[model samples]
Target: MSPQQKALLLPKKQGNFEIGSRSIPSPGAGALLVKIHSAALNPVDYKIKDLGFFVTDYPAVLGSDIAGIVEEVGEGVDNFRKGDRILAHGKFSNDFAAFQQYTLTDARFTAKASYEKIPSSESFDSAATVPLGLDTALVGLHGNHFGAGLTPPWTKSVGESKKPIVVIGGSSSVGLYAIQLARLSGFYPIITTASPSNEELVRKYGATHFFDRNLSGKEVKAAISKITDSAIGIVYDAISLPETQSVAWELLANDGTLVLTLPASVKEDEGKGRKVISTFAGPHDPQNEELCSSSWAVVEKWLSEGTIQPNKYEVLPNGLEGIIGGLERMKLGQVSGTKLVAHPQETQ
Candidate 1:
């Protein structure tokens, strides 16, 4: 029998999460077996339980942000070796999810920053906050089908554009990365909306202009106009609430694209060139595969060079058990401007 590992499991659709045990899976060809050190929480984890979306199997393990040490390397993979610290974007599959002490990761999505490249100040908890948020932001902005189809910054000779872009929910995980990536794309006067208290945090993530999230659509538009008169050609609504969606739509210029993290709530104007794209951040998705693979290739360099920064995070207590309460806080909208991380290896 394979060694068993602790996992946070949802036994059924819309069911409660509990500490359970599952066999640690092995690395397959082109995969790595990771001993998870930190697992970060996302709103989608609870949404999966509450709405019964995504997973079809019972007793499912759900988590997407993973940071850990490579325990074993499978055939055909040479970039990583045992004992290397790495981070990966996990999928919903049981073997690949982040809620377990050990999980399998596809080599294409795994990243390890060399000690010389990454600042010594980086931690497993910090790295765990990145994968999902960075991928979502990358795919939404550059993916031809899953995103706005903008030219990726990775390609050579791609000059920066001076166009302005707005990110609603700027303090949220995905929104924060979107703001930074927008900055990298050379979008000037990057504007975003978040709680007034998080203004400094969002700005640190590269937002050039900040507005209170409570501002009405008209108010936000007026505030943004004072900074840049450039038409807002791209709006990444990371929150994707109906209210935020409405505001994003209202602020978007004709022919602009609004990228949403949730399903579109606002109806598109017929004959208007505006496009609403609801992004699915999974790298495993065929439409997103190429774009995400390319981005993952450079994630290590981006982190090391300070071109990308991880979200601020708070570590949850009590290992796998603590994730339950963390999810509740997220559902209640109590968490702001930080990711919640769990140490699965500490599970009793």
Candidate 2:
């Protein structure tokens, strides 16, 4: 029998998550076998168990933010070797997901998905918070199909944008990355809305202006009008709840794109040329493959240079088992301004 690893499993559609055993998988061509150290929880993880979307296989594992050590490098891969610490976004497939002690990753996404070394400055918990949030923001801001179609900062000299961009829920994981990427793209007065308590946190991520997230849509809009007259061309709503979506729609200008992490609750008006793009951020998706590959190539530099900072995270107790209560807290809106991380290797 193959070596076994502990996993958090959802035995059926809408089933409860339980600790179970799964065989540690081997790396295939252009892939690496990872011994997962830390896995970060996302709202989607709990949503999957409740709504039963984005996954079809039964008795499956679910998680997307992965940080670990490479255990084996597969045929045709040379950039990574055993014992290298790395972080990569997980896929929905059982063998590639993050809720297990071991998972497989594509070494680099030239024409595939990617994995890269964690910067020495970061801990596994901090690095685990980055993958899904950063990818969601990147695809929403730069992907032609799912994003606003802005030129990526890594590409040849398209000068910085002088315009302003709004990010609702700026303290949220995706929102924080949006603020940073908007700064990198040269969007001035990078306006964001979050709890007043998180103003400093969002600003540290490059939000030039901040507003209380509790404000009414019109009130926030009126406040923003004073900051920049430049038409708000992109509104990345990381929260994507009904109320937040309404505020994002209210602030978006004509011909602007509203980027959502969830399905759009507000309809787009065709006559105004405004668009509502719900981003599916997993790099494994064909639509996002190329754009994400380009970004992944630079992630190591981004982290090391502090060009993109990882989210603040709190490590949960009890390793993998603690993720259950963390998800419950997330569902109750109890977790705020921080990612919850679990140490899978610490599982009993």
Candidate 3:
């Protein structure tokens, strides 16, 4: 029998999460067996339980941001070896997800951060925050089908554009990364909306102008005009709530694109040439595979050079068990400007 590992599981659809045990699986060809050190909590993790969306299988393990050490390298992979500190995007599949102590990672999507390029100051908790948020932001802005189809910054001779871009919910995880990517893409006067208290945090992430999230649509639009005369061609609504969607829709210029982390709530104006893209951040999807893989390839360098910064994070207590309460706080909209990380190896 394979060695069993502690995992947080949802035994059935709309079921409660509980501490459970599952056999740790081995890596297949082009994969690596990772001993997960830190797994970050995402709103989707709890939504999968309460909303019963995404997962089809019972006894599902759900988590997407993973940082850990490579335990075993499978055939045909040479970039990573045993004991390498790495971070990889996790899929919904139980064997590849982040909620378990051990999970399988596809070599193509994994970032070996211990390489000479990445600074040693990066921690497992910090690295765990990058995979999902960074991918979502990258795919939304540069993905051909899943995003606004902008030119990626990683490409050579990619010059900066002075166009203005707005990122709603700027303090949220995905919004934070969108702001930074906007800066890298050469968007001028990159503006975002968040709580006034998080103004400093969002600015640190590359937002050039910040507005209070409580502003009305007209107010936000008016405020933005005072900052930059450039039309708002792109709006990334990381929160994607109905209210934020309305604000984003109102602020967007005709023929613009509104990128969302959730389903679109605002109706597109006919003949306006506006586009709404709801980005699915999973790298395993065929449509997103190429773009995400390309972004993942440069992630280590991005982190090393400080082109991309991890979200501020708080470590959850009690190891895996603490994730339950952390999810509750997220569901209640109590967490702000920080990722919540869980130490899976500390699970009892």
lDDT of 2 by residue, 1-348 (tens): 999999999999999999999999988898989888889999999999999998999898999998888889899987788888788898999999999899998776311112244444446777898899999999999999888888898895545678989999999999999998888888888999999989999998999899999998899889999988888888999999999999999999989999999999999896989999999888988888888988988887787667788899999998889999999999999988999999998888
Q: Distance (Å) between predicted and true CA of 167, model 3?
A: 0.3
Q: Compared to the true structure, candidate 3 yields what TM-score?
A: 0.97
lDDT of 1 at 307: 86
The sequence of per-residue lDDT tens digits that candidate 3 reaches over residues 1-348 is 889999999999999999999999999999999999999999999888999999999899999999999999999999899999999999999999999899999998999766444355547888999999999998999999999999898785545577999999999999999998888888888899999999999998889899999999899999998988888999999999999999999999999999999999898888989999999989999999988888888988888777888888999998889999999999998999999999998887
Off-target runs (Cα >4 Å) in candidate 3 are: 115-122
Deviation in Å, model 3, residue 239 alpha carbon:
0.5
- How many backbone clashes does every candidate have? 0, 0, 0
lDDT of 3 at 285: 97
Full candidate order by lDDT, most accurate first: 1, 3, 2
Question: Candidate 1 versus the native: TM-score?
Answer: 0.97
In candidate 1, the residue pairs with backbone N, CA or C atoms under 3 Å apart (3 or more residues apart, or in different chains) clash, namely none
In Å, residue 228's CA in model 1 sits off its true spot by 1.9
Off by over 4 Å in 2: 109-122, 157-160
- TM-scores, each model vs. reference: 0.97, 0.95, 0.97
Q: Which candidate, 1 or 2, would have the higher lDDT against the true structure?
A: 1
Residue pair clashes in candidate 2: none
